[model samples]
Every structure is written in structure tokens, then in C-alpha cells.
Target: MLIVGLTGGIGTGKSTVSKVLRDAGFPVVDADVVAREVVEPGTHTLEKIKLTFGPDIIKNGALDRHKLGDIVFSNNTELARLNAIMQPVINSAMVDKIAFWRAQKVPVLIIDVPLLFERGYENNDYIDKVVVVTTSPQVQLERVKARDNLDETKAQNRINSQMPLADKIARADYLLDNNGDISFLEEQIKNLMTELKGIAPKYGTK
Candidate 1:
């Protein structure tokens, strides 16, 4: 299978791009969703999180993501500690899901991992292409604030935490700009999809 790793900075319409790819018949393996799944009620990840961050991180029998985010964001040591505890589990689960897609002989699999570059896992041999969604900083801030219901400062902080859009573009094999309306973004994705179809088979299509 051709694994396309799609990523974007906070609020760059990465999800929208992923939706476009899915609508175009590509199977998307969402890392964020799988991360949550691995930490659900009975999972070992949840237990480890509870033990590491304590019962306070849980609310009404479910992990309070906001509370945990607050803790990690406040302290770099805490954030690194949390990543250490969670990343391995998330990565393993993602690999397993991708393996299933490969077994099914899917032509294209989009792994929507927001931190693909930041996590330093961008060039995995399994990944055939890296597509980064791009947008201006102003647009990114505006979109993220509106979508996440976050204030300017908070949204900026989140944006600051990720790799810059410029670096992502430099590293990507393909770029989809989402600085405009939905229709424009959709068109860009369509072009990229057509481009991928031509490239994948040459790389020894699975």
C-alpha cells in the first residue's frame, strides 16, 4: 500500500484535507483518533496515565483531556514525561492499523499524524509521500480560535508549539494550501490525489 503521511500545523485545515482524501476513496488512519482509542476506559495507557498524572486527570469516569493538557502545557518536564508514556502506545497502535490496511490491499492509506515532523518520524520507509497542508499564520490563528473556541493567546501558544509551516512545506513531498475557501482547498487536494496516483505505481504499488 502507498502510505501518505499528511500533517499540518494547528488549525491549518488538516482534517479538511483528510476528509477530501477520504471522499476521494483513500483510507485514512487518523493518529489522533487512535491515540484516544488506546487510552479509553480499560486500556493500559489509561491506567498508566492515571498512575502518572493521578486520579485528578479523570472526570466522570473518562480522561479529562483539557485537564491533562493544562498540566503538560504548564511544564516542559511534565510534557516530555507524558509524551514518553503515550507516544509508544500510539505509534504501535497506528502501525497495527496501517498493517491491517496493507493486508486489505488498499492502494492508498493516508496517515493523518499532526506531529509527523515534530515527532521526527517523517521519513519512515513505509510512508511513500508526505503531504503538508499550508496556510498563513494569520489565517491559522483565526481558524484555530474559531474552531477550538480558544482565545488569541492560547491559540498562538498552541501554534507556537508545532513546527513552523515553512519547515513543513520544505520537508513535504507535496503541499496543499488551505488559505482560502473549502472549494479551493478541495481542488488542491484533488490535484494532489491525481499526482499521487501517477507516483505510487512507479514506486512499486502494493
Candidate 2:
């Protein structure tokens, strides 16, 4: 099966495109969802996180993600430490999901990973292509503030935490520009689905 890696910076509506692709009948595995799943309460990963970051990060039951985020987002070394614990677990689970989709005879599988490029998922053997969603940085900041209700400084901090959109664009095999209206974005996805279907059948058929 064809594995397509979908990535974009924060507030670029990557999830919106993912939803559209899912609605179009593609099995989309969201890495962020998988990341959270791996760290669910009582999981080995969660235990490792508590051991590494401290027990205080866990709330009454679940991991206090905001607390963990506050620590990691400010320190690159801390973020790397957390990634070291979670990345492999998430990747393995994601690969299993991909295999499950392929067994069901899905033609094209979409892996919507926010850090597809950062984690080298795009270069992995499974991913056949990479699609990077993009828009103006100003639009991104505004959307993020509006969506998450963050002030300018906090929004910028979140945006700066990821690899820049321009760098991702340079690596994209396909680009979905979400600058215009929702209808325009939808149109791009429809066209992309048509194109991908043409190529995807080859893997599923034989």
C-alpha cells in the first residue's frame, strides 16, 4: 500500500486536511493521537516518563500534558529526552496500524504526523510521498491565537517550537496551500485524492 506522510507547522490546519482525507475513505493514522495513546495512564511509556521527568508531571490519574509541555518546550534537551522515550513506541504502533490497513486492502494510507520530517518518518521505507500543508506565517499566528485563545507571545512561542514552514515546503513532494477559503482548500484535496488514487491502485492491485 502507498503510505503518504502529511505534515505541516502548527496552526496550518493540518488536521483539517487530515479530516478531509479521512472523509474521502483513506485510513489516516494521526501521530499526535498515537503519541497520546502510547502515554496513556499505566502504559510503560507513561511510567518511563514519570521516572524521567518526575512523578509531579502526572495529575490525579493521567499525565499532565500541559505540565510536561511547559518543561520540554522550554528546553531542547528535555524535549529530546521525552522524544527518546516516546518516539519508538509511537512509531511501532503506527506501523502496526499501517499494516492493519494494508491487510484490509486499503489502497492508500495517510499518516498525519506533525513531526513527520523532524522524526524522519518521511524518509522511512513505508512513506511513499510527503504532503506539506502551508499558509502565511501571519495567518498561522492569527489562526493559532484564535483557535487556542493564546496571546501573541504564547502563540509565537508555540509556532517557533516547530521546524519552520518554509523549510518543510522545500522537502514536500506535494504542497497543499491553505491560504484561501475552505472551499479552495477542499478543492485542492479533492484533486489530490484523484491523483493519488491513480497511483495508489498499483500497490493494492498487485
Tens digits of per-residue lDDT, candidate 1, 86-173, equal 8999888888998898888877789999999988767577787899999999999998889878889877877877778899999999
Runs with alpha carbons beyond 4 Å of true place in candidate 2: none
C-alpha lDDT of candidate 2 relative to the true structure: 0.91
lDDT of 2 by residue, 111-164 (tens): 999988889887788898899999999999999899988889878887888899
Angstrom error at residue 96, model 1: 0.7
lDDT for each candidate structure = 0.86, 0.91
lDDT of 1: 0.86
* Poorly placed runs, candidate 1 (over 4 Å): none
